[model samples]
Target: MVSQVVWAQVRSKAGRLVERPVRELRGERLEEYEAVWQPPRYQGRRAIATWWRPADRARHVGCAHLGALGAAVSLEADRDVVAFASWPMRLHWADDAGGYVPDFFVRLADGRVRLLVCRPAGGSPQRWEAAAELLEAAGKQADWQVHVHEGTADPVVFSNLQRLSRWRHTRLADADTARVLRKVFAEPQPLAVGVRESGLPELPTVAKAHHLIWTRKLLIDWSSPYMPHRSLVWAPEGVV
Candidate 1:
């Protein structure tokens, strides 16, 4: 005789269980497990992502505004983070108040899931403290770390990142172009010379340089305001 377990595996089009009569369950209501929830609506001033999520491997698309603060977090997460989500899930805060959706959910290389929110540097303490307390309660319930980032990002650095990220989706230039750039950077040099020596048009050359910098094939002072012409760049040791 076919067991009830075998019969339970058959599901109908509407996600209802196809009940093949079995001894263990004669008239039991066959209900399928619920499907994954898709949010019916989203909140926030919508913006498209320039970067990918490390955790879910989801390619770029629309998401909540990263602005200055969120932009800073995105770059760091790409480097040190194991994975992250931008407002991926909702956490219910209380019965009366609506659910809170964190700005980011990061899983660090150290295996911690951190919930992060960004606000203005001069935001109200009382409101933020209340938020922190609510997040603390939420953390206790879900066993995750909750953090708040309250500040404006450095204007120069942030602007430079915005410019550089434009080349992130660009394809690498030719082999000869890459070779010339590498040879120029065989010693630390102003990126301008490398761009000129590539013999490519300045636009494409600069774009290639941007890609190289983004992929870590080249290094420069990311600490300060970045200038394409005068920025010093060096290839990793032994990099041809």
Candidate 2:
């Protein structure tokens, strides 16, 4: 079956609209899009405009709703994501059916680009499925990845991510304390035990430990409920 052609429109940094065929977008051009794109303001019931500062990037990202904000938090927690922007572009069908503004554009550490759509769980799955089809087709043509993220399936994990994000800022990191943590958690141990064994002052060491976990220098069972004293923590393989 022949795939439908897709085109993208984005606002440039100077506030000019620029349109291009999806097939033509790749490499350095993606960065240009990120630099220029701005998220649209949302209005009406449950609509909100908010900003998030990701640990991996120095700038604040705008989110259009709670779901988009959650998606941004998930992106921030992902170790593989190098950078991301919300509402980066609008995808239009060449046939002029309509257009969609995807919720996020992500640049991964392995040099892959992804387009993301955010929807609350229990929303119209059929509608989002159709949107995913169009976006995925565009992604294929552009050599990009695509996803439609429903609301958090695991509240435990999402809660844990939120907790860790509080410590995600680089300002919380202590190199000396991190080194001690890496060795102390070289073997799997409870969170409080590892922090205490670091031999630093309790308060600061605990914060640094959480920061390391946020940065993925320390690994935890994200699937499990987080506990300050009981949750297990360990360094990734070969870290010690």
Candidate 3:
């Protein structure tokens, strides 16, 4: 009862200070079903399909990358693990599933699950911190291991590294740190192969150069291999 009262007070105070609906800019809508990249690179329906869709080749490839990383590090470690991306968490309302979700979900061979929250570096720090706290609180009641990864130097490996940073090497049971090292430091081959096989390399000059991949309903155009662009917003109605 005391804890609930304290939480209510905290929530009331937070509501007074935090911004309600945070918005990020994508690109101008060219038509009802299309969005032209203001600069032509990672803004259209294709780009969204490529990076955001769970079934997209790139997204699956990322999962493989995480798994491979875990497997590789297991060779010299004492842990058994499996890793994947976009493992959505069911949000609960008063006791049922709520719409809020967490990003990555990792499971150990023994069945323990960990919820990972990853935020790209260039995002609003305040919101990122708030999100981390929210996930942590949710984990406390849900019995899942919770973690947050912050984007730093490269967006490509942002979440991988941020979550890896939590371990206190001194407290790690083994020097290998299987989970940490595997996730944040995996090889780039899997991603490259999947991207090429997706016909990303055979597309037209503009599409290829912009990293656009065609999907049944949309196009994911304009992605960068370098810095992270955690800044993304949903498309408007009638605009892809």
* Highest-scoring model, TM-score: 2
Regarding lDDT, does 1 or 3 come out ahead? 1
The positional error of residue 142 in candidate 3, measured at the CA in angstroms, is: 1.1
- Residues 1-240, candidate 1: write the lDDT tens digits: 111121112234575533332222222221112211223454762543343433233333223444534544454425655545554444443242343455665666766567677653456887666556666665554456776665435666556665566565435545666666787788877888777776778877777877787767787777777787777887888878
Q: What is the alpha-carbon lDDT of model 2 when measured against the actual structure?
A: 0.79
CA error at residue 171 for candidate 3, angstroms: 36
Residue 104 lDDT in candidate 3? 49
Tens digit per residue, CA lDDT, model 3, 1-61: 1111001101122233111110110121101111111112444423221222221123331
User: How well does each candidate superpose onto the true structure, as a TM-score?
Assistant: 0.61, 0.81, 0.32
Q: After superposition, how far is residue 207 of candidate 1 from its true place, in Å?
A: 1.8
Cα shift from native, residue 70, model 1 (Å)? 4.1
* Model 2 residue 231 lDDT score: 89
Highest-lDDT candidate: 2
CA shift of 142, model 1, Å: 3.4
Q: Candidate 1 — which residues are off by over 4 angstroms?
A: 1-73, 109-111, 120-125, 170-180, 199-203
Each model's Cα RMSD: 11.4, 3.2, 19.9
lDDT of 2 by residue, 148-191 (tens): 77778999999999888899889887888878888999899998
Give each model's whole-structure lDDT. Answer: 0.54, 0.79, 0.31
Reference-based lDDT, residue 184, model 2: 93
